[model samples]
Target: MSDLLRLLPWSGPDGRRCYVSADSGGGPVSRLADRLEELQLDTGAELLDHVEELLRAHRVSGDELRFCVHRLAEALRDALRVAESRGRRIPVPEDEMEDEMEGHPEPPGLC
Candidate 1:
């Protein structure tokens, strides 16, 4: 395994986060993940537009609201995963990292 560990776009069968080792970002798995990330981001943007329209209606049904919320939750999950994966790849200085760590006593959970 390479020293570079990339958080995968999809989770494991048990719903746990997965990682892949790839020194070069052009590997098949990395390429597939990149495509999936792009799809996720585009889907999130489209979902946001839909949600705005749905919420602006004069009369909104309970079923419609429920469905919207469900899709929003799914989209949020995807967006968060994408953010986390990208965030990890960013280079941060030790002093800045320490400052961030000091502000937050503990790491936040996905929930």
Candidate 2:
């Protein structure tokens, strides 16, 4: 029985904040949140890959390029929010190891 509330990463459909009342951050709801955050990170990685390809191919028009960039920005924001919520640094997914290793420090447990 605790009187503390935990912040969730996402807002409600109506754009309102949400909170969960949990004694510990290891319950079913917390597990679900972890899964969701991982998914969001993965999706952001995918979006980044797609955006890179699109930029290299030079196939998108002015408006389409703008839209793609917007989506990419949103994806980055979502991934960052997930990392913040989990109190961890933004984890570069395995598929991006080559790019990350170029100039960034290795993520935890990778060395």
TM-score of each: 0.77, 0.64
Q: Mind giving the per-residue lDDT tens digits that candidate 2 earns over 43-88?
A: 8889888888888997788997898888888888887776565553
Q: Please, what are the lDDT tens digits per residue for candidate 1 over residues 31-55?
A: 9999999999899889989889978
Question: Least accurate stretch of 10 residues (summed lDDT) in model 2?
Answer: 102-111
Off by over 4 Å in 1: 94-111
Lowest summed lDDT across 10 adjacent residues in model 1 is found at 102-111
- Top model number, lDDT: 1
Prediction 1 TM-score vs. true: 0.77
